[model samples]
Target chain A: MAVASAVAYRPPRLARKRTRQAVLVWCFLAPSLAIFLLYRIIPLLWNVVLSFADWAPLRTIRWAGLDQYEEMLHDDVFWEALWNTLLFIASAPVGIVIALGLALLVSSEIRGRDVYRTIIFISYPLMTVAVAIIWRWLFDERVGLINYVARSLHLVDRPIQFLNSFVWALPSVIVANIWQMLGFYMIILLTGLQNIPPNLYEAAAIDGANARRRFWRITLPLLKPSLFLCIVIGMLNSFTSFDLVYVMTGGGPGRATELLVTYIYKLGFSQTRFDYAAAVTIVFFALLVAIAWMANRLSGGNAGAVETD
Target chain B: MHRYPRWPIHLVLVGVSFLMLIPFYWVLKTSVTGENIFAYPPSILPKSPHPFYYVDVWYYIPFARYFANSVAVSMIAVIANVVLNAMAGYALTRDFPAKAFVLLLFLSCMMVPFQATIIPAYLITGRLGLLDSYLGLALPQFSTIVCIFVFKASFDAVPRSLIDAARIDGLAEWRIVWKVMLPLAKGAIATNVILAFIWSWNNFLWPLIVTRSADMQTLPLGLARFLSYQEDTTGALYAFCIMVLAPGILLFLLAQKEFIRGLTSGATKG
Candidate 1:
């Protein structure tokens, strides 16, 4: 009805050219709209439907109602994964703080800012599979760099199994994730920092404010938007924690690092329980929607913070 | 010479940079040396550089096949992202009824994570008989909301006079977009291409679900299989890592400034 109202009052004389322009517009929009429908919107709706149905390899699909959600409630692994997913969300600020620190440093004129920026930002572009592979090697028990340094410094009698230990698995992956992501946050934050009006800082300095005072009084308040953007983007990124968790531990050492997406993969593909996984997907989808709604509020209705590559 | 003390800042930045480059240096060093990678007191430097592992990785596994698949998929994704996204973006820029609705649709699509969409995406791809096909792997990635916005932002930047002048000269709407606008938006296009390449090449989950045959696996999937199957061999894994990671890194390096500008413009303009 709203759309009908929008195009209803096309004046008859200008209708032809308007129609021409409209045809051209849709001609351009066809491919993307089709993709959006087929790949995104349809799949999302299908996920919602599939959650309420059960699938068996040889047997026919049957309506399971909330059976899958019931199973999810009883599953201990599901609870653990839920906990780990929250942990992953909580881990966002670790990377953000580090990135803010690095961004603050690099945004200033110390020296070799370009080199620092390039090297720091390099990891963001590398494949997580490769980075995870390297980190695996680094965290190896025997001659891995972490072990080597620990042993040399007499910090331990043995190399800690960083990826293998349940206690350390999430933290280890979190460290690698932060290492990979800090640069991206730094770059984003650096841009935000550069956008701050210099006069604000200049006036603060001229009024006998110290460097610390200037940062708190001038920089911190202004930098809140960028910081908030990083927080939300980082949390959104934490949702798709499949690749690193897969390569690093395979969500392993007994499902210690199992993120929800990884658990969904395990259920759907590994166990052939698509219905249960679909339920998990729906639940998480709702959670993310709530988070995205909050992100909209945080960004003051500019929700582009959630729309990243 | 700076206002703040330079020494402390330089020291901190250099230290952090080194920490950041640790994984790259370790991978490169291990792949080259072929020495006891797990030996205690890990060699800080390569004693004997052995580049043969790169060759060994190819013969041991079908690295060439995976590399080729990745290349083809990434290239197709890049081209499609550039062209189709630019079209949708251009269309959104026009003063048409329901423009806000269409734009909202795109943004909402962006919010839906692929984890939710993967099950049905697999089903649809299976229905199309595209499972294990390159087109199937590359198809869903063709258009992203980010790319559309990039192009729209670029199109918005093209001065109204330039587009109007092209209109006066009898160019069609798309021709105006193509001839008058796209050239000016090469920075956006380049960023889109690089980002699309990285996303496609690094994508492991969808391919893992879609691909059954070993030969059809992309490089990331292949490396993962190697890590799981040949868990003892570190050198070949490093070699594969170096090979798979280099292209994306080099592409980013080549287009660093444009990429940063494109990113920040989307960021600030938002």
Candidate 2:
């Protein structure tokens, strides 16, 4: 009877150990996972659910399936917002180009590269909104530094209203966006550059390939993964850019700078049209997924292009 | 290529970096100019740099309080995020029932841009009555998928033998993680903490939505409202803008090495 009791006690101890492991794992994951679900995932799911229902704070709720979607189809503001979003996202290529340029320039065996890298990379960690405000000052109509420098050098005839005027606002935002992002993609591309063995570049040089040709062949092919990542992330960031545009322009000059996210914020928060806002978010989600997929597809094949071209 | 001096590369990079600093310089100049911003031609360099604007910004807007709030929220959030993320990441890499599924869930969450969920998040916070509190501001940021992803890779590089030895000695799973894994992953932990700190400090949207009162405002939001209230670039207010960004810039300078590493290393790895 004593032996039986001891054997039973050993099984319970094993069970106790397993239970302890399970509890420990959950404790480790709970804080982050709970916050993630409460803030991010729950909101995401609720956003979808909210798309089908009409509700406002301090009012009765009614579920109207697909009505919000139907309204969005004919909403001119929606289309205008979509156009503005495309305009902003068009800045992605500029980011890629600047990133590529920085990557190429810094990859060279040069003095002070680390200092340059640090300076540019410094901007990446700073608040984007702060960066935007600084850009706003630089683009101020009367006393902006850009105008002072350009006009002093006889580059332009007038002090452009970079933030207010229609012609300059989009481009101004795009340029600022590019400036803020250039270092980020550059760092990523530099990493990719580092991963490429020096022997390959050496072998290409031995084959009598010139600098431009070698870059096109060797560097471009090797750097495709990072380039692809930069492009995808750039696209997403541009598509969803809020802070810079919010502070610099406020989608101003009569909604000229309104992107999808800004538009959604206005619809839901300012106007209290929760249902319609949810619809806009759903569409933006689809656009993001599609664009991401397309980018992946295009980037995947570029490796082949790198070889063939 | 050799025709262009290597100096040109340095010249261009240094030149661009100078361009980057121009706005920061302007912030300093404007804040101290002690003149109305609406003057016909704004002075590029303030004739006199006054320290009074910083004082004025602080007095007029509860700048000190908001600065404290921002610091408290960000520091707590960063510490919590680093610790929790490292543990979850270590476990996911080491022991779990459905490891791949859990990781994939996190990855997909990463892809779900915050724009898609800000409203519902706002609602949930409101429901929980967490609005206008530091916990409200910091809690959402505490669960960053990026940190988890970075820490997981760092922990993967830890030797399995450490865990095995600890188990042989009958150290519990939690202690093995706390004692064995954490000391070894210091670089990654520092990277995550600093990155999280910067992000939390710089965050605008969550704080904007959740914290309604000026008393509850973080530094960035407070500075923004102060700027908007000024409506034009006055010398003193401009100085305030520069002052607002000083801490962040200083932190960046101090941890520039980790900042660059975190930014570059995380992007490529994931």
Candidate 3:
């Protein structure tokens, strides 16, 4: 209806051209629309339907009608996973601060800045599985370098047991996650930093402003849109994080690290409770929607001012 | 002499960069180190740099096959996405009925997580007899929402006058998009191509689920198999890590410009 109303008031000569354009547009959109609907959208709707029924892959789906949702409301594990997901999101500010700090440091007229940027960004392309695998080895109890170094420096009495311990496992994973994500965000934030006209800083210096004051007043406001974008994407990505947890801890140590997405996987695949998993997934989807909507409302969803890759 | 002496800043930047590069260094060091990786005071540099670990990984594991499979799958998937998304992006942005409906459809696809469809996708693949095959891997990614979004943004950037002029000529719609639009959008196309390739190459979960046989595994799945070997051969594990990382890292190095450009393209809108 919006598009129809949009095209309704065109001139006659433009009308024929517009019709042709319309046909061309559909021809372009068909394949992608088909695939997205089939693989992504339909499955989402199917998951919603499955949530209301006792759907299992091997057995006939029986309508449960909000029983799963009700169960989720009472489940302690559900609450735990929710809190962990929030914890993970909370962890992202560390990465943001690190990224912004690096971007600020490297964005200056430092010699070899390009080399530094390239080396830092190099890890972004390495497969996440390889990173997780190697990091796991590094976090190993007996042989891991982190514990060895810490012990050597008299930082701890014994090995830290990074992954095995319930208390340390999530934080350890969070550190690795931040490491992997920092380069990408730094590069992103650097671009925004560089976009600020150099003249502004020069003028500020001429007016006797200190570096700290210049950064706080001039740089921070100009970089708000990018910072806001980074926050939203970082939060969303952390909330739905699965690969790191799957590869590192497998949500082990008695489900201490089980995120909502990971929980959805366990319930559906491991427990064979598809309907319940579907309900969980539906709620998870709602959470994502709510978060994105909240961010948009906060920022006014101005694609021109703030967007994320 | 001290006009531009920000040496301390440089020192700090280099320090952080070294911190960034440590993991890659460890990967290289561990792959070549002798059988003492688990020893205390880990070797800063391997005393005896053994190159045979690479050869051993190829011989002892099906890594060669996995590498080839990854290359094939990533290439096919990237190509399919590039072509399909270019068309879809052009249509949705430039012309067509129900334009708002189409755009909303694309946007909503981004909202749906793949975890919801993993089982159904497996069932579909099974029904289509696509299990443990290349099609099962490549087909799903071809309809990627991210690529469509990228291409649509690029197509939107194309000047309206040029498109109108082409239409004024005797050019067909397909010819206009193919000849006129695509040729003008090489930078964006290259950006999407590299991104799509990197993503497809790194994908582990789908391949792990779909492929049943060892021979059909991609590099990620192959590395997982290598890690699960229980051999405790640290050198071999490092060698496997290097193999898994080498291609993606090398590609990233080569396409660093595009990688950064593509990543920041959306970011700067803020």
Candidate 4:
């Protein structure tokens, strides 16, 4: 009887202890989970639902069923914004290339490399809005430094209206974007460069691999994960660059710089087109997920930079 | 190892660094010298720099109020991030049911960039009646996935024997995290604090959407409004920009090692 009683006691107590741990782990997780659910997951699902309904603040939401997407089909601004966003994504490789060069330079044994890295990275951590302001002034048409230098050096006939011109506005914003992002890319690539086994280069040297051949064969392939990471970040920047475009040009001078994010903001807050904005949001989210998926595939099914598991 | 001349590398890096730094120099030059857009031949150096423009910025707007608002919001975010992320990260280190699912959830949440969620985030914040308030401004950024991972990496590096010893001493799970774990996770905590502070400080859009009242505006919004209001007429706008950027730059300069580590933590681990 005593043995049976002890056995009975042991199972329940063990089960209770397991239950207690599960509860404790969950309790620890509760706050962060609550915040993410409220801010990220719920809002994401709600955005999807809102896209399908004609709703505004304080108005009853009514199901519209593909109407918003249909409107998006004909909306020229939507197309332009989408095109501009893709252009931004396309420009990512340009920044990455330059950053790669900078990374290689700094990663080598050189004087004042840390200082150079610090100076290059300083611009990145500045407020984007403030950076926009600074760039706007730099690109100012009349007394702008760029114009002054151009006029002095005979680079152009007149001060180019960088932010005001349709052709120049998008590229100008892209330049600013690249400038701010270059440091971050360099750092990531620098880390990648540092991780490469020196013995691989040594092996290549013994094989009579020239510097260029060694770089092409050894350095580039090993840097795939980091390169892919930069590409992903660059893609993500298109959506996240709202503040830069918003403050610099406000998607103005004929929507030349109108990114999807700025367009969505304008539609929802400025124009009170919540339903349509939600639709754009869904499309934007889908684009990002697609990019991530493609990036994952491109990295041979393990996007190490973004690996979840 | 092959040796190469260093001058060319220095030359190129110096030129690139100059390009990277020119904008900041230009802004600082304008702010102090009160150079307007019409200042021709754009002086290579400041003719006369002064602090009056900063004073003008201070007087032109409610700079103090905006500064206070920014500090409060960043404080809430940094403190909450360090505490909550430490707990969540500690929880992640332990074996538990659905651990994989939780991590996947966190990863997916990261992909849902905050910019894409603005419309509904605003609506939800409105529902919670937190708009135009400090909590509303800081709520969305209270916990970030990367910082959580930073804490996890730091905690994972802590020796398992120490935790076991703590457990043997009859320490509770929370107590283990507090007494045994946190003492060793100072680097992660610093990373979290700096990253959280910078993100909260530099945030523009959320505050733009959430804050309706002028008084509720943060430094970024204030600087934006000031830009529009003044339109670069005086040096005050640039002064405001400098003032707005100073804290972030200062913090970055002070703790750049940790800042860079926090950013590159996940990338390097992979």
Candidate 4's residue-wise lDDT over A184-225, tens digit each? Answer: 999989988999999999999998999899889989999988
lDDT of 3 by residue, A1-309 (tens): 888986886568877777766766676677887778768876777778888887767688788888999999999899888888889988887899888998998887767889988887777777888888878877878767687778889999988889989999999888888888888878878988988998998899889998889989999888876777677778766876677788788887778888988888778667878778778877877887787677767765553232322
Q: Model 3 - which docking category? A: medium
The TM-score of candidate 1's chain A against the true chain A comes to: 0.91
Candidate 3 lDDT tens digits, B1-270: 126579888888879887888877776887887445658777676777879888888777877798899999998899998899788767656544567676676666766667657756666677779889998888788877666667777778889999889978978878888898898889778988998898899887789778898878999888777777643455877888887888788888898998787778767662
The TM-score-based order of candidates, best leading, equals 4, 1, 2, 3
Alpha-carbon deviation at A134 in model 3, angstroms = 1.2
lDDT of each: 0.84, 0.79, 0.79, 0.90
**How would you encode candidate 2's per-residue C-alpha lDDT over A1-309 as one tens digit per residue?**
999988777757777777777777777877778887887779888888889988888878788899999999999889988988887887788888887888888878898888787777667777877787888888888877787777778888888788889778888888888888888888888888898898987898888999889889998888887887788778878987888888888887677788898888888778988878888998999898888878779876533111100
Superposed model 2: Cα runs more than 4 Å off:
A1-23, A154-156, A301-309, B1-4, B34-45
- Model 1 has a clash total of 1
Chain A only: TM-score per candidate: 0.91, 0.88, 0.89, 0.95
Position A234, candidate 4: lDDT: 82
lDDT minimum window of 10 residues, candidate 3 chain A = A300-309
Residue B40 shift from truth in candidate 1, angstroms: 2.2
Once fitted onto the true fold, the runs of candidate 1 whose alpha carbons sit more than 4 angstroms away are A1-13, A295-309
lDDT computed for candidate 1: 0.84
Report model 4's interface C-alpha RMSD after superposition on the true interface residues: 1.3
Query: Which CAPRI category fits model 2?
Result: medium
